[model samples]
Target: MEFYSLLFLLLPFAALSGWWMAVRNQRKAHSLIFSRYQKEYLAALKYLVDDQPDKAIQIFTGLVEVDKDTIELHEALGNLFRQRGEVEKAIQIHQNLITKAPLQSGLRSQAIFSLAEDYMRAGLFDRAEALYLELLESGVYKVPSLTALIDIYERERDWTNAINFCQQLERATDKSLKTVEAHYYCELAQEVLNREDPTEAQKYLEQSILCDPNCLRALILSSELSMQMRDYAQAINMMQLVLGRDPSLFPLVKSNLRQCYLMLNTKSAYQSYLQSLLEISFTSPILIEITFELESSEGTESASNYLTDHLRKNPTLAGLSRLIELNTKLVQPAQKNDFQILSELIGSLSKDQPAYKCHNCGFTASYLHWQCPSCKRWNSVTPAVTK
Candidate 1:
């Protein structure tokens, strides 16, 4: 009876021991699997760091099947695929995350955004537009979605939609997009002007100025419209406003202003205006225009003297080229050939140099661009004033 009682007491203890052993073995197996997964993850990261994306992508795709909790890892892999220009793979990955994975609401939104970016990279703007529109309802992605939609509209040259979305973006961020909006209005004005509707174009320009009082592009366009209407005085007033706002744009309007002055029969007034401009900013373009005026009105000797004095004050390649050009006419026949050669060489050099440079991105162009082609910033490309 004593032996039987002891065996019965030990039975519960034996069952408890078996349960503990099974739990330990199961934990060991789970730990080994986790350890293998960690090693594979590190190896994939090594492939990415070494710029071997194809191998990294393969490893990551396999890992995703084993672990569905890697939402962040999936995002990283999608970005990597996009950067590698593998848009199809990126789309597939993010789509799978959104549809196949059991993600919460926030993770699902993130997957959708990633897929939208993939579409953008692939230039599937229509598809990307749809996805971005869907994301607009999500608070976390609202601003970015609006911004992306604006970019898409701009690319499509859909100014109406661009302006509408821009207004929404302005309200969302509470920061002024007046300058960008002004540019949008100017774009609309340009389109109407192309369609031979000056009256409609004028309305857009007015709206642009209303948005930003100091919009240089609108003023210039308005002046151009005034010139077309044969209203010289109005054109002159508008151009002067442009100069007062940004004198660097003198190169753009110099010829127009000269023509307006001539139309008004005000040569003396134009000369006076040039002199005043020179007094304020002695740019090469201003000096060159003045020289041409003096040469035509006062004579070559007077123009040569005026240019020589200014050159002494502000030496520039353009000034030097003009001086050489003027001297070529005055030089003896023997020296004329040498002066012409030097002038040609200087002209060749200046031709290769860009006339405008973007302050935002260092992008250079031969002509003025109100918006930078590279960085896409407004009013960034300005006259390149090389010393």
Candidate 2:
């Protein structure tokens, strides 16, 4: 649809270029030629307006042949082909433009860039990467070429190359890429950790924190490393720092924090910390976790009472779901069935809902992402609805 629209958009440009080419040759003889093309242009536009863009595209592509010397016509046709997913045809058109004798330097560079784009659209990363690097070395389209190289490297999971190109892009565009670079470092850290190289992993995690001090992924990895090494105190401290930075991360680190507290015989301290969070109205997964803690340490009645009060202050689907769950457990044998049915209904409502969503594009997912998968924006995916 976008491709056909682009063809329709180029109709006037193609017509003007065709007319100009005919006038440049011999006005008297080619006047009829220009008139024929003018009628064809109006017909193509009518086809487009009538929702017959394929017919419009065919007419326009043929009209460009009226002035083969018109580079803009060829370029527009190439772009149309590319947008239509006919990358081979796009590449051929741009390649022909590059091979034209006496081509201007600017036109040559444009053709190369266009060809590289065709390669990218065709998923021929190696071919596209080579052309982009060539363009970069030529100092033409430096920022675009560097950006393309960064995307290609990232897609290939070549973190070393990705980091290098990302830094170059940052310098060329004067844009801060520290947050994205931090994710690259975290990726490296995870790779090292998978290889049982905790020492090296820690070094990468440190670099990540240096890039973005409040990097939650780095903190999470650091805590994991400490836990693997039996350093419960250090793990707890790191998670506490995470919660301090973003209380929304409480659910992600809750189990780890609980394990650390249990390992150190500090459940009471953990409970006190949770109570402090509730005091400030940090009702979220925190409240849910606290309800479970109360159920275990106190009783069903105590947990029920606490949730009932919390719900009065700030109610949410999750809070309502938990309240229903608690009631199901507290009710008598005959009454339990009704409460259980209500609990099941509430759970079904929220079960398919995602815990995280992209703030930029509104893409929802079950797990956390440092970069929004849909928008490709760094630090844009965040916890949804505080749970």
Candidate 3:
């Protein structure tokens, strides 16, 4: 493009020299042609310099057919089309540029990348993938092309290809791929589990942990797989490991842990654990779970007292309602209805609450998602706890 502009500036001198060569025979016609060309080109250049790309592009497009010198003008018009969301036109222009002879390597690659982007924007993932892979195999535009391929595979849920591309990415930059690799393993493990292949699922989960030991999703899945294999003890161990790593996740594992304890027939063990945990921190759901257990074994009196004691320090509607529900049957009929009403009110209030939230995107979800649906970030969504 710089070559073109430099050549343009020297066109007048070339014309002057040509006029000298032709002598006085065709001077008037040459002068008229030079004047017309110079006037339009200078006007277009002024608009281009002033950032009036619409007018500049229009004037430049009109001039492209006049000479092969307008290749840069075609590029400007293509970029303008892309900026205006006319991706088809942009693709056409860039594709045309690659076909032009004597193309510079930089221009050729730019056109290829731009064409790939246009395909991506047009929802042609296969086309985009092909171009990105071609760029990758060419051993040029490696980083950006691999990045584009990664995004394409991610969007398509082709975790295998995404994993491969990210491996290349880590090789290219030596940036850590620990978290992403872990998520990729998690995705594969989830699919394996859905296909009822526990053996392969276990392998992927182990690989996931090795890739990122801090991945809570891996822990959760590990516990789930252990439970499926009926290793309640190991399941309980995994859930506790998750809690020790991040106690704020207790709410997420608490219900699951309760189920594991039930499966192991270890109620007393869980009761002792829950009592200590509640004293360390308040949990409305654990309080409910514990009160239910207490009422089953020790009767309503102990359960009501236990719930009442916790409610005094860290009260919530759920805790208060559980306490009232436990005591309502033990109460005299006159006061029983009043406690029941309060219990019902608290139940209604808690009904509309969201159970999980994404810390990264402020997206509320009714159930936990290992990867945020809105932001597509792994482990950002967690159980919304009350403590």
Candidate 4:
């Protein structure tokens, strides 16, 4: 049933349950309980009609104290409160249920888990962590509790604990967390790099690749570390490894790669790498980067001719933008203004287009993100190929 409709039905059902208890005076012990339910049910109806379903759920959950049969109803009410962002109310209901002496062990565990979720939603990570850890020790909800613990550690930026718990989860479930483990190591590498500890950063980066041999971020970081240490040859080799792993991500290391080649005075070698990358992945950004490199080495006319010929085979708005830019640089004084206008227009068209997108959630980004921001999945965001 629909949400509002379901809630409306619950009010009547709760009232009927109370009425039935009141009628059967054969159980005198239930008299006070029935009266309490009736009072709370009316109050809940008032809150529901006031368009405050959260408050109404709070009232209904209290009816669980009067009617044992209302345990499921109270659980549903707590979940509804949680879904509505009434986390405190949800926590109250779950906590109250779990504390009740006569509650079933299974139901109490369920309440404990639900309360942990409530804490998580409310950003009370400490509370959530404690409850999840308790659940983990109990060994009832091992996977979910461990998963929650991992998330809490990640949000806390406690990578050591996160990595440990992730490994624990992997061993328990017999599932691979190689990708996530690799990102954790990469994160550690970045932290060390920021502290100017290149040697330590290199170790973490190596661990990242060891965790997942296909970790693109590991290669990129290794390249950056090599460059920082003034090892241009190693940097270039690391970048080449990046290209071999995923040619579509060339733009990420483009500027750095160019600097490394120039530092080593290997312009010809840089051109050869570009040529090989273009052959493997026909992308506009790669083509444009190569055209600019060629323009610096071979002159405007040569670069313009090469780009124009390449565009005929593999056309893209970004390519057209570069072609116009090259032509603008080569045009005579009288026609230069017109070519500049065309170049500006093409630039505008490609400016807002993202260069990468999350394959899982369709989240678009101008730069590479090893993990998708929207879905939080590792290595799901890929380079967006523009024709």
Candidate 5:
């Protein structure tokens, strides 16, 4: 009986020893695999440092497996592919991540968002839109997904949908998007105007003004609508409201105001309005327009004299160019050639200069853009104050 008990204890110990040996061997194999993966990770980094992204991508794609442990690595590799403009590779990697059955909910959302970004970069906006909408429904990437959808709608010129997503985005975040929303309405108004539907366009412009009470574009559009309806007095009133709200927009409304006054047979009233603007500030374009009015009503010499006085007060290349033009008309036959040469030289210089510049990004353009094309900011592009 004693021998049998001792043997039984020995058997238990033997079983425990066998279990320990199996664990030890498994850990050793795991350590070797980890060390090998570590070496490949270092090699990938080295390739990246050498600016060889293709080789780095190859190594990283090989090193990273689609598991929860390697989720971040997979995302990193996918982003690398995207940065290198290897969008197909990025899509493939992210698509694989989403397809994995064991990926965590948060990680799967990340992969979907990344795939959507890849589609956007590839200009597959429809595909991107669908994915972003799905993410929106999931509520995992609410703000970012809404913003991406808004951008997609804007790119597609689907202003109605753009406005809808913009409103949702506003609710998702604390930031106010009223100005952007107003611009969307203005875009819709423009489309309506293009279709020769003035009444519907006016309704849209009215909504834009309701969105942003001080929307200069809406006010300008309203004035244009009035002019289209042949209500010159109402058009003048709308433009006056524009100047009252923001005098810096004088350049945009000056010609329209002049036409309204002309239709009302009120040239003197227009001159009086110009004089009032001069009292407030001396903008070169305003002064230049005044010179034209003066040349039409008064004589060329009088217009030249008036511009000379203003030029002395506020000298600008634009004002100087206008003065040269007036002098070109007034100079004597002997001095006409010299005046013409000077005018041409100034014209050449001014013609190449951009008329509008974005205060946000310093992007310059030849004509007015309510939104800066480079910065994509609304009401940021304004008349470049030439000097």
Candidate 6:
């Protein structure tokens, strides 16, 4: 039956019969032994509805006695209060459960974990850490305590501790964390980058790659560090590795690769890379780069032909703008101005378009980020193409 229908049906008889029926049901469920707990529960219910959670918690705690069979009920109530942001009441419930002696191993561990979560909710990280460490010592709630410790260490910017705990978690859980490990190394690499220690940063970047060969953040950092050391060949190799590992980053890293190859005077390799990049799924910026190279080496005719063929398929504002730019280059002096106006219009259209977007939350950004600004997820941002 629908809840509303039951409520309406019971409404007329509620005041007269509900209290008597409730008392009868309580007696039926528990006689002399549970009589005290039943009274406490009803009193707690009254305080709970009256917005006096403190008194409710106290009444509930006194009724638990020695046995821990009520652990589920306490846990349920604690979770409800915590979900309602009543951390104080939740903590009281869990703490009372913990104080009850000879609780089952699992139940005791669960109560302790719940208490730690309550402390975390109350912004008492020290208390939370103490409870979490105690949980670890018991080895009953190892995974949960380790996970909470990881979050705490990350929030506190203690990467070393975070790394150690993450490794411990890996060993305990037998779960692969190579991806997160790679990100941690990248974080260290970035820290050293800001500290003017590219040499140390390079080691962390290398470790990141060794941890996960497909880590794009590591590749980006390695390429940047290679640039600092004037290792253009290695810089180019890193960008190429990124392209193979994560094609979504090609738009972000391609120009840097172009610059690196140009610095090393490797036009043949640049042309080959640009050509491969042009036909990939992420193709617009790659096409633009290739068009520029073609215009420089093979003249405006070849570049215009390439763009014309591609634009017939994709027809982006960027592609059309490049076509106009190439056309104006091939135009006679008199007709050049007309084509130039068309080129200017396409440039204006392309100029104001957003270049990057967070895939997680659709947050637009002008530059790429290793982490999404809105959702805070790693590698969830991609290039937004102009049309």
Best of the candidates, lDDT: 1
Model 4, 27-124: lDDT tens digits are 44544554557557666756766778767766765555634544554666677678878888888878887876255466677778988999999999
Model 1 TM-score, all chains together: 0.81
lDDT scores of the candidates, listed in order: 0.81, 0.80, 0.75, 0.80, 0.79, 0.77
The candidate that achieves the highest TM-score relative to the unseen native structure: 4
Model 5 agreement with the true structure over 200-296: per-residue lDDT tens digits: 9988998898899989889888888888889999989999888877676787888889998998899988998988877777777778888889999
RMSD in Å for candidate 3, one decimal? 9.1
How well does candidate 3 score on lDDT at residue 165?
87
Displacement of the residue 67 alpha carbon in candidate 6, Å: 4.1
Which structure is stronger by TM-score: 4 or 5?
A: 4
User: Residue 344 error for model 5, in Å?
Assistant: 2.9
Decide which is better by TM-score, 1 or 3: 1
lDDT for residue 73 in candidate 1, whole number 0-100: 59
Tens-place lDDT digits, model 1, residues 1-387: 332232233334332234334434554354333455766766665665566767866776665443333455567667667877889889877887787455556778888999999999999999999999888866659899999999999889898898999999999999899999999999999888777788999999999999998899999989988887899999999999898767778989988999999999998899889889778777888889889999999988889999999889888889999999998988899999999999999999888778999998899998899879899888899988733
TM-score between candidate 2 and the true structure: 0.81
Better-scoring candidate (lDDT), 4 or 5: 4
Clashes per candidate (backbone, < 3 Å): 0, 0, 0, 0, 0, 0
lDDT of 3 by residue, 218-263 (tens): 8988888888888999999998887666666776787789899988
Minimal lDDT window, size 10, model 2: 1-10
Deviation in angstroms for 15 in model 2? 12
Candidate 6 matches the true fold with a TM-score of: 0.71
Q: Which residue window of length 10 is worst by lDDT in model 5?
A: 3-12
Per-model C-alpha RMSD: 11.7, 5.9, 9.1, 5.0, 11.7, 6.6
* lDDT for each residue of candidate 2 in 52-83, tens digit (9 for 90 to 100): 75676566556533333455555776776788
TM-score of every prediction relative to native:
0.81, 0.81, 0.73, 0.85, 0.83, 0.71
lDDT of 2 at 272: 89
Stretches of candidate 4 exceeding 4 Å from the true structure: 1-8, 11-68, 101-104
